[model samples]
Target: MRAIKKVKKFIERSPNSTEGITFAKLILALESENEFPVIELYQLNSDEFDLAIELLKDWRIDCFYVGKAKAFDSATRAKNLS
Candidate 1:
């Protein structure tokens, strides 16, 4: 996955960005261009990816799926439980 490789390269180059803006920009750019390849690339490393997870917690953008999936799945399961 070249996209994943690119993101990894970016992270490697900028490993100390606590602001997460850079990761957000990468995500947004991929999404804006409908680049699923890039998007999935990011997802693969989302767990220990960056500070972007915190930044994207409340963001309305569709690019943040790291924490989003667990939250969404939990909600759906809870509804089913109820």
Candidate 2:
């Protein structure tokens, strides 16, 4: 469970990344359910955030899958936290 939280935090804030403010907005969108164009409740590896944009790819709970753009966009700075 701890590892999962870490993933979320990294997605929430990649402090070591160089993506800038766009990264932050992506974080907000990931955490937010209805605030952004996407809604991702599962955690993903930092590197995979940009390329893994599949429906029901890594979900912990089963629900309607509506895959959108990967990581909200390439502009989102996502750094590996592990």
Candidate 3:
């Protein structure tokens, strides 16, 4: 959950940033049966970009299931709503 918390904090610190929005969407994709474009990450600064890659790596290796499960549940709910 640390990585997810860090990413949430990063988004909170710069809610209006393109990187924030992009990361938010990327997280959503990670949580669901969806895919995000790798090219979009090129828009981020090094730190943000690294975090995005870290998220992917963590998710790929199934390192954070509980948090990802919660995120996926939330995404499923929102998708069902709209």
Q: In candidate 2, residue 57 scores what lDDT? A: 34
Q: Give me the displacement of residue 38 in model 2, in angstroms.
A: 7.7
lDDT of 2 by residue, 1-82 (tens): 3333444565567655543333445545554643643333224445545433321233312222333344444335454432
lDDT-superior candidate, 1 or 3: 3
Instruction: Tell me the whole-model lDDT of each prediction, alpha carbons only.
Output: 0.53, 0.41, 0.83
Candidate 2 lDDT score relative to the true structure: 0.41
Using TM-score as the measure, which candidate wins? 3
Report how far off residue 8 is in candidate 1 (Å).
5.8
lDDT of 1 by residue, 1-82 (tens): 3344455565667766632345646566655754333353365355434434433443444456656998999999999999
The reply for model 2, stretches above 4 Å from the true place, is: 1-6, 9-13, 19-24, 35-46, 50-82
Evaluation by TM-score, superior candidate among 1 and 3 = 3
Q: Give the poorly placed runs of model 3, Cα more than 4 Å off.
A: 63-82
- Candidate 3 residues 1-82, lDDT tens each? 5567778998899878898899889888887859898889998888888888887787676746777898999999999999
Q: Candidate 3, 26: how far from true, in Å?
A: 0.3
RMSD (Å) per prediction: 11.4, 17.6, 9.1
Q: What count of clashes does model 3 give?
A: 0
